[model samples]
Structure formats: C-alpha cells, structure tokens
Target: MHSDGNRKATIARHRVRLAACALLAAAAVLAGCERGSQIGAGESTGGPSGCPAVLAGAQAAVSRAEKKEVFWNGPTTGPAAAPGKTIVYVAQTMTNPGVAGAANGVREAARVIGWNVRVIDGGGTPAGIQAAMSQAVAVRPSGIVVGGFDPDSTSQQVSRADAAGIPLVGWHAVAAPGPSRRPELFTNVTTRVEDVAGISARWIIAHSHGRAGVVVITDASIPFARHKSDLIRKELATCSGVELLAYENIPIPDASSRTPQVIASLLSRFRSRWTHSVAINDLYFADAAAAFRAAGEKGSGPPFNIGAGDGDPSAFQRIDDRLYQAATVPEPLSQQGWQIVDEFNRAFSGRPASGYVAPVHITTAGNSDGATTWDPAGYREAYRRIWGK
Candidate 1:
C-alpha cells in the first residue's frame, strides 16, 4: 500500500510540472503577439501607416510653392518728400531684435530719401502704444509706421490719424486673415501666418516619418503666435498618427522663467510617446531643447524640435550641435522692413499700396551652416533699386 501511494504521488507531481511549462509557453506567445500588435498598429511592412496620403499631399503642396519669390516692380522713384518732412515709426519695442531691425530698415530708407524720421518706443505695452500714437499724431508726420502693435488698443488714435490724413502702414502688425478693418491702415507687409504654421508642421511630419506626437508651445500674448498655433493644430488634425500631447500657451511675460518647467514636466509625462515639439518661434524651442538635455534624455531619433520666425541664433547652434532642434522657418524680417518702407512710399505717392507677401524659407542644420535668417534672392539690390537709393 505504501509503494502504490508513492507511485501515484510521483505521477501527480510530473503532471503539475508539465502543466506549468505549457502555461509559461502560452504566456510568452501572448506577450510576443501583444508586442507585434503594438509595433504594427501605426506602421506597415511597406512604410508608415498613418496619414501616408496626407503626408504626400502636404509634400506636393510645399514643393509646388517652394522658393517662389515676390519682388516689387512698381515705379522706381518713391514719392518725393520735402526736405523737412518727417516719417514717424512707432516701434513695438527697441529692445526686441526683430523690431529693432525693422526700425533700422525704416531709418535706412528714410535716410536715402532725405526724410527726417523719429522712432518712438512703444515699450511693448498698450498704454505705451497709445501714447506713441497720440504723440505721433501731435507731430503730424508725413506718415506713420507701426511695428506689431495692437490695432484695437490704438483704434481711436488710428482714427485720429485718418482724420488728420496720415497714412498708416504696419509691418508684422496685421494678424492672419487681415486687411485691417481700420481704413486708416494702408497695408501690411507680412507672410500668411497659416502658411508659416503649415510649412513647419509639414517639416515635422516629414522628418519624423509621419509619426509625430507633438507638444506645441504657444505665446498667447502675441496675435501671430496664437494664429500660428491654431493653424498648426488644424494641420496636425489631418495627420493620423500625430498626437497633440499638449498645447501649452506660455504668456510672454512668464516665458523666460516658465519654459524650462513646462518642458521638464511634459518630457517626464510623455517621454515615451512624445516625438516632437513645435513652438511659435525659435526662442521657445531653444528653451525646450536645453531642458531636454538637462534631464539626461539622450538620443535623437524622435522628439525632435522645430520652430518658426526670427531664427534665434541659439536655435541654429542647437541644430548644428544636433541636440534636439531640427529646423526653423524664417520670415524675411529685414526684407519685410524694407517692404514696409516701400508700401508707405507707395501710399504717400497716392498710388494704391501694393501689399507684398513676405517670403519664408525652411532652414535646417544642414542648410543653415552660416546663416540665421532668410533673405530673398537679391533682396538688397532689389530694394535699393526700387527705392532708388
């Protein structure tokens, strides 16, 4: 009886061991299947799965419009000005490099045309802009140029200028979807905000191979920033595999202090899934890239960053170093400044102001080795010839 019991116990133990091994094999197969499903979920054996058609369409559209230049072919002689006549430029802020560059362009053109020019610093505040506009009207300059000031805040002053028969020209001032409602506004020299956002989105998608999980950093205080953010959201919606993990609107005042925190928080939360960062401009992208490096996240395949406008020098350096920045779409800021002068000249001459679409170009680490901004082909000569400088 004891021998028989031992034999039965040994058989039962073997049976249990065989069952456990089978279960382990089953679990391994199940795990492998799960991984396979994940890998194939948004990709194909042939190529990327999500939004292939959309990607191709975007590429075609960009290709169709790539590097198309617009030049001013109006009368060579700008409106003749009396020796003492003056032009007033209401700068957004002299402190801003881009605004300062525009001011310089205005100054240069005014110098060539023998017109006195005064630039009032708007101090980047509504009150300052209003004050500047009021002061400009008091002086009764030949014309007025505004650099990215809020039109509504200065509407009354704009009305006053119109009543006083002063032509107002804006550079980088008009928001997207604008021919300013204020009839006093003569024209705006700017690129379509949507186009800038769209091109940037396309670059992200293409470079990431159509699988972009993006974090968009926007500045709500700036109308152009909001416009760019909105358009980027719209474009990315059409892309299937692209997910918008966060749409962070960093107020202009807090951007310097808040950017690092924002980037760190988002990286920690979405490090595995996030693949790109799209910022309103290069300034924010630089901050994000620095934060990424500080956090010890190493590798460059996904989570690339890109931006639009101003082409901050630091951003170009980041791209060169291959830290995280991938590309930047630079608006021809200085050239736009010259265009502002040309438009004002046209208005002063009683000719209809020809609003020129500012040109933009995508600069990568590869293409932007020695450059930080986009200058249209022969832009200097073209403007000089037009202004008869």
Candidate 2:
C-alpha cells in the first residue's frame, strides 16, 4: 500500500509540471501577438507586419491609459474627427522644404477626405513651437501636426488638445523622454530615425572596408539626438571595420561664434587619432567634414570617410563632390505626411488601419546618377483619394 501511494504522488507531480509547461508556451505566443507595428496610410489597416514602431517608449504608456477617461484643457468633442465634420491640420513650421512637403501631403489628404488642415511655424525653438501649439489650441482645429516641437513644451498643448477631445498627431522627432503629468501623445505619424540611422551606419562600415576607427560627432542637445545616435552606435558594432573612438555632443547656443570654432576643434581631434567622422546632419556635421579633409594626413583611407544625415540636396551635392562620404536621404516628406492623415480618417471611419513600411533605400554610387524619387504618382493618387477636391 505504501509503495502504491508513493507512485501516485510522483505521477501527480509529473502532470503538474506538464501543465506548467503548456501555460508558458501559450504565453509566449500571446507576447508575439502583442508586439505590433505602426498604423500607417495605405493597404491593410493596423496589422502587425506593416506598422512602424514610432514614439514607442512613450506611446506604450498610452495603452495603459484609461480608454474612457478624458482630460481638462480643450473641448469635450472631437466632432472635427467625427464623420462628416471637416478636419484641419496646422503645422508649426513649413519653412524647410521637408516641412512644406509634409504640409503639402497633409493638405492634399484633407482635400480628398473633405477634412481640414492649418499650419503655423514654431521656428524650431521651445518658445516658437509652444506659440504654434497655443495658436493651434485657440483655432480649435480638428487635428494637429507637430512640425518641430519638443514634447516637454508640447505636453501642455497636447493636454489641452486631449481635453478638448482632439487627437494630436506627431511628425519627425519628439521632445525625448521626460516626466510629464499628461498622457503620452498620439502622433499618428513621426519620422523613422533609427531606420535612417541604421542605413547610414551600414554605409559607413561597408565603405571603410569593415575595419576602421571613427569619431562620432553626435548632437545630444536635441531631444531625439541621443536615441538616434545610440542606435547608430549599436548598428555600427555589427559592421567589420568600425569602432567609435569618441562621441562628443556640441551645444552651441550661438551658431555665430561656436559653429566654426566647435567644428575646428573636432577636426583637430580627429586629425590626430581616428580617420573617420559621422554627424547628425549636413550643415552641422558638414563643418566637421570640411575640417577633417583639410587636416587629414594626405592619402589616409579615402580621406577619412565622413557622413551625415538628411537626404537634402546639399548633402547629395557633397556626396557627389566626394567631400562627404554619404548621407541618408529621408525624402518626400509629403508622401509619409499625407499617409498618416489617411490613417486618422481610416480609424475614425472604422476602416482597418492601412499600414506601410517604406523601403529604407540607400543612396549610393549605384543610384547616384538616377533620379531618385521617394514618392511617385501612386502616392499622389492615394493622397487625392484620402483628401480629394
């Protein structure tokens, strides 16, 4: 009898272990389902594959927010986003071609869907962006486009919009990670900094023969600067001939006095130890590229490979002239900008969220001569259908 009792207890324990294993397996499957993508413009709406993870760390908190809860700043009704009501978008800064392209995309979308859009320039400053948000609040627009505003300052404006039952969409970068008493933003759209950064890093590694040391002149002052730069560093590690010797962030409030001086110092340092440089953009990092070329010991590894961000024509010109090695082309802001507008309409209309992961194409010697267009006729048609005449 004793032997039989012991055997039964062992059998029961084995059954319990098997059940635990099954539960763990089920949880693993659920986790994969939860890891979703960005809700984009065209095609299927809100599917996992096509979504781009934008404003992830911050936006994650929104899911934990009370779905039925409302705030106390703006309106209680988002009739602008409601069916048959016009939706208006206001951009804080449409000065740069990139920004204007974004506005153009948004406006075109509004026209198709019979929505509305309004834009104001925040001048790319804290006060400037804040004022733009303020004006947007006063206009009581249907929706908002954060042209170049920081989150810390934009948070209050977002609160005001949220309270009024308006959905705020973000474009490009946010104000980095900070503690705010407000809910995380709901930017139907934002830039893909990491995607572009990875492309840029891969370019650097491939060009440098897989083994080289370089200086990273990243701009840390900008809220999203560290995030992009950090990703670049990680990707670079995977490349063969790349080592980030040192990274220095320049905070020059005075562009007049410090710009040249700062670049000059960076050049001096790179001249001594490393043979490469990577910067965040054309103008700022262009200064360093010029310095390194001038100071580089003659005939040292393809003139010390230097690259920057932005697909702007100026960066292309430098790449052509071979003054700069390469720069990522984040082009046709109009295409993606309008795509996000389409997203809001789809959600409000109860249509599936169309998703897209634009190809992260590289602009290199292979495609240098060819006319590279980021968005095409199909893009225009999509915009027209969403916000038509």
Candidate 3:
C-alpha cells in the first residue's frame, strides 16, 4: 500500500511541472508575436535592448549641439562682388519662415554687394513653383535662387536656365549641400541633413534616457523634407527602447488645417504612450500646439517636441516660451542666405562653389538667451569682407 501511494504522488508532481513548462512556452510565443507586430511598421530590432551604449553616445552628441557660442568658419576668400548683377529669388512660399528669412538675408547681402534682387513666390505647389521658376527664367536674371523647392519638379525650367548659362543656386533644395551635376545647382545652401537628423534623434534619446515612444512628422511633398524625415526615422531606430509610434505625413501648405486634426487623432490613439515628437520643420509644432492645449496638455509637455531643421523666429519663440517645442536643430537661415549670395558671386566670376556647410546647432530655452532666431555671429561680416563691400 505504501509503494502504490508513492508512485501516485510522483505522477501528480510530474504533471504539474509539465503544465508550468507549457504555460511558459505559450507566453514566450505570445511575446514574440507582439514584438513582431510592432516591427512590421518601421520598428527597430537593432541596438542593445536597454541601449546603455547608445544612450551614452547620444548624450555626448546632444551636449555638443547645445553650445551657444558658435563661431563662423565660412569662406573668407572668394571673388569680390559681381556688381550690378540681377538675381531673382524663386520662393517655394513666402509664408515659409525659412524661405523668407533666407530671402531677407539675400536682400541684406545684395544691398551691400550692389545687386538687384527680385522675389517670385511659388505658393508651395508644384504648378506654382514651376510657374515661379518659369517667370524667373523668362526674366533672364543673372542667377536664379531655387528657394525651398525641388529643382527636378521644374526640370524644364532648370534645363532652360542651364542652357542659357544662368547660374542656379538652391536653398534647402537638395539632399546634400554642395554642387550637383545631374540637377545642376551651383551649390545648395543648408546644414547637412544627416547631421540635422542625427542630432535631433539623439536629443530625444538623451532627453528620454533611451526610453521613448516617438512620433515623427514630415511633409512628403518636398524631396528635401522627405529625405530629412527618412533620416530622422533611421536614427530613431538606433535605440531599441525608442519606439516609433507613428510617421505623420502632413504637407506644409495643408499643415494649419490638417495638423490640428491629426494631433487630435494621435492624442486619442496613443495618449500617454506618445512621449516625444520631432518634425522636419518647426511649423508643425506651431500647428500642433492648439490641439494639445484643447486636450489639456500642459504648456510644458510629456511629448516634448523638436524641429529637425529651419529654425525660424516662431520656432525660437516657441522654444524660449516652452510652448510644446523644447528644442530645434536650426539652419542658420540668414547665414545661409548670405552664403547663397556669396555662392552666386563666385559663380558669376567663374569660380567653383564655396563648399561651406554650416555646423549643426541645437537651441533650447535655457540656452536661447531670449533670442528669437539662431543667427550665428561673424558670417555676415565674413561674407562682406569676401565681397570687398
């Protein structure tokens, strides 16, 4: 009777152990499926799960970009101003602060350089941009500034300009800044998009301590803007804990109307999970602020925001006030504007492009010192001296 009892007890214990093992296996499979679902929509499996190494590197990079005292290291020697030259600025839209800011710089420089400058607004449409480019080419200006729009979209106009020997310069018009052979730009004026993208992503990583649920906003209509957002997405993926919650595509023209609605939807769906946001341009945050306020989000934010490029005055104000935007990787719009005019001077004198790319900088309220724009020092004087004005 004792042996039969011992055998029955042993069988019962073995069955319980088997049941526990089966339950663990089922949990493991379910967890993997959940991860698989997350990854199907642009999630990353790279980097260490906790991202200790990545977090340290990101913190260091953000430290470098946040410095306030930046000096200009642009071309000090170039052809003196090509005087009396007429240049027309073909704008993507005057409403875009970056474009207008750069245009203002061009006017400032042109006044010193003794050149005539005209602006033709593109209205932020392909047709509108093409019309502007056509008008610019028809006016037969000494040069054409492709301000904040793709040159390829207006290929015929670009080709016409090239054929007519009118030098073309682009501001935020290409992926990389410098001379291009295929699209045929004298040089593109802007910060390196990769640097902009990386630092913005690193800002989020450092700010969040490697754990964040991020939403990336971009305008898919412009090639430069689209490429910038794509780079931002890739950099965000470097930290395994930084989950990309959504990639929103709201065109710049439609942003004012569309962004509020989109932000409402995102808030409803993601709620507390969306811990941070980044946009290719700062204006999205401008549009998003109202929606956030309506939903009772704080003037400060759980979804701390950053703009990847084009640090306009409004963006700086937003950062300084801490009204939803925390930081910006601002292009020296005014400096780049001066650079654009200088590049045209070089082109007119039959010289090669200046090959000067601005260093990336990040602006936050603590570092802003009540400034409304990120206008670095010394570039204006440097360009003036080069132009011998």
Candidate 4:
C-alpha cells in the first residue's frame, strides 16, 4: 500500500509542471502578436512609429515656412525667441526708392525675427552717411544694415563699430572691392539689377520686332545707376539696331531742374528716331511713360518699353493707366523686411549667418491678363504657402 501511494504522488507532480509550461508559451505568443500589430500600424501611418527620423526632418522644414505674402521665395514665419539677441538695422539711405525698398525689406525681416531697426536716410553725400552711421554705432547695436553706402566717409565709424564688436550687413549695394572695404562688414543683398536690365532690354527688343532704342534715366549718385546702366548697355548690345539713345541720371529732390516733362522731351526727340525706350528703375519709367501718354503717343514709338526695378503701387497705377509698357519686377518691400528678420533669427539661434537672396520675378500685364499691375493680394494664400501664412 505504501509503494502505490508514492507512485500516485509522483504522477500528480508531473501533471502540474506540464500545465505551467503550456501557460508560459501562450503568454509569449500573445505578447509578440501585440508588438507586431503596433509595428505594422506605425509603418502604415508614417507617423511617430514607422520612420521617426524622416518624419522629424519633414516637420522641421514645414515650420520654417511662414505666413507672410511672399514676393520672394520662402514663407515668412514668426520664429519663437530662439536666444537672447538684439540687432539694429541701418539703411542710411537718403531719398532713393531702391534704398526705400531695401529698408522695407529690412523692416519686414526684423518683424519676423524680433529685432530693432533704425532707419537713417543718407542724402547723396558721404558726409551725411558717415554721420548717420556714427550715431547708430554710438549706441553699440548688435549689428547694422547699410544700404549700398560708400564707407569712405564712415570709415571711422565702421572701425569704431568693429572695435565695439558690432557686425554689419550691406543691403542693395556694397562698397567697390567690397571684400577689402570692410571684412567686418560683409554680406549684402540687392535685387539682381543686371537681370532686370536684361529683361528690360529684351522686352524692348521683342516689342519693337528687333528695332529698339534706349534712354536710361538714373540717379548718378546711387551705386545702382552705374552698375545697372552698364548692364542695360550690355544687354542691348545683344540685339541689332538696338541702341541706347541717352543714359540720363537725374538727382532726387532736385528733379525740379529736370522735370519729368523735360526728361520726356529729351526722350521724345530720340523716340522719333528710335523705336524703343527704357529706364533704369521706377522713377525713370514712370516719368517717361507719363510724358509719352501726355503727348498722346500710344505705342507711337517702339512700344514705349520700360523696366521698373521695384514694383511700387504708383508704378503699377501708371502701368494700369497704360502710361507705361514692358515689364515690372516685383520686389515687395514689405517681404524683404521680413526676410531680414528671418536671417537674423537664424543667426541668433546659432545657425549659419549665411546670406540669402530672395527670389524675384518680372510681373507684367500679360502675366495678370493685361491688368498692367501686380496686386499681391490675389495670390496671398499661395505666397503664404511659400513665404509664410
């Protein structure tokens, strides 16, 4: 009887061990099944689960796009205060539309990046610019943005600014031999003046059927005048019988001596002989276009081709009135200011302080169904998508 009882007890112990082994295997299978479902879902959704590295980079790029109406490339965004930083923008340009346009860009850029800006209008004199820069430097601002100023007069101020550890940026134009001028003050942004000139010349040539003439009105004091004037001549050189009748430079605030009518009269004389006409920037074309229309000459002389470098509302109005023809380049002043702010934000965030060019294009009545103007609002949503919204 004792031997039989011992055998039964051993069988019972074996049965319990077998049951525990079966339960352990089932739990392992269920856990593995749950894990597999999670992996599969993450892959399908392309969310946090499937490819985390790729998703993270894509999200970052999307944030960089902003809400501003873009005239140039890239959306404008309100960057959170990345780091403690302060910057001062100094245009220091006297009454020049090009400078004004640049200032507008700088202002917009500042608003985006959250920086302070100090605008100084530098009359067509080096002394004035020097004084303006000196005053700005005295405050020891983080950085200064100058609009194509010749630093000769501002040498002392620039040197002082460097000593004080302030950085400088040039907008629109930089001093000649710019590299040597201010190693400390590097980086400049200007619309592609040559590109605009090329477009102007080509439009004239196209409108004239290869017969064209040029009358470039410019401000001799501004750096843009000579550089752009040279480009006009170069591009016109590409077409036969296309000639520059006169390259005139009229000073701002002194247009009284050379009224738009007077300039127009000068151009009119050449128009009778040549089939086309053009100007260096907005003022030139606006005035010339007015002169031609007031004279009751519509398409009378070579399509009255003119190129406006900055697309101001007044310029567009003139275009709408059919007082002007040819193409106008859109350099939204507000958008430029916003880009400056964007760059500043990057620098403050310890990213590259690399300079960037905001892309621009030629806007004409043809592009907008003969509207003869650019209303950025029509494409605001699209602009926001690229620039910021």
Local distance difference test scores for all models: 0.70, 0.52, 0.88, 0.54
Write candidate 1's Cα lDDT for 1-389 as tens digits: 99999999999999999999999988765553331123211232124547888878766655543444545442344554434457899977664556666777778766766678899988877787799889999999988987766666788888889889988887667674224755347887667887888888877666555676789988777676788799998888887877899999986445667888998998788765676778876777555656877877652424667776666556667676766677677766666766776677777777776645755567766666566556566666665766566
Each model's TM-score? 0.79, 0.64, 0.88, 0.67
Supply every candidate's count of residue pairs whose N, Cα or C atoms clash at under 3 angstroms: 1, 36, 0, 25
**CA displacement after TM-score superposition, residue 22 of candidate 3 (Å):** 23
Give stretches of model 4 more than 4 Å off: 1-87, 92-94, 175-183, 253-265, 289-294, 299-303, 368-389
Give me candidate 3's TM-score against the actual structure: 0.88
Q: Tell me, what's the RMSD of every candidate?
A: 7.3, 18.2, 6.1, 27.1
Cα error, residue 165 of model 3, in Å, equals 1.0
Order the candidates by TM-score, highest first.
3, 1, 4, 2
Model 4 Cα lDDT, one tens digit per residue, 323-343: 655455655555555445554
Model 4, residue 261: C-alpha shift (Å): 5.6
- Best-performing candidate as measured by lDDT: 3
| Per-residue lDDT of candidate 2, residues 10-128 (tens digit) | 99999999999999878764552231211111112112311122223212322222122222221112212334544445454444445556677777766666666666766656687
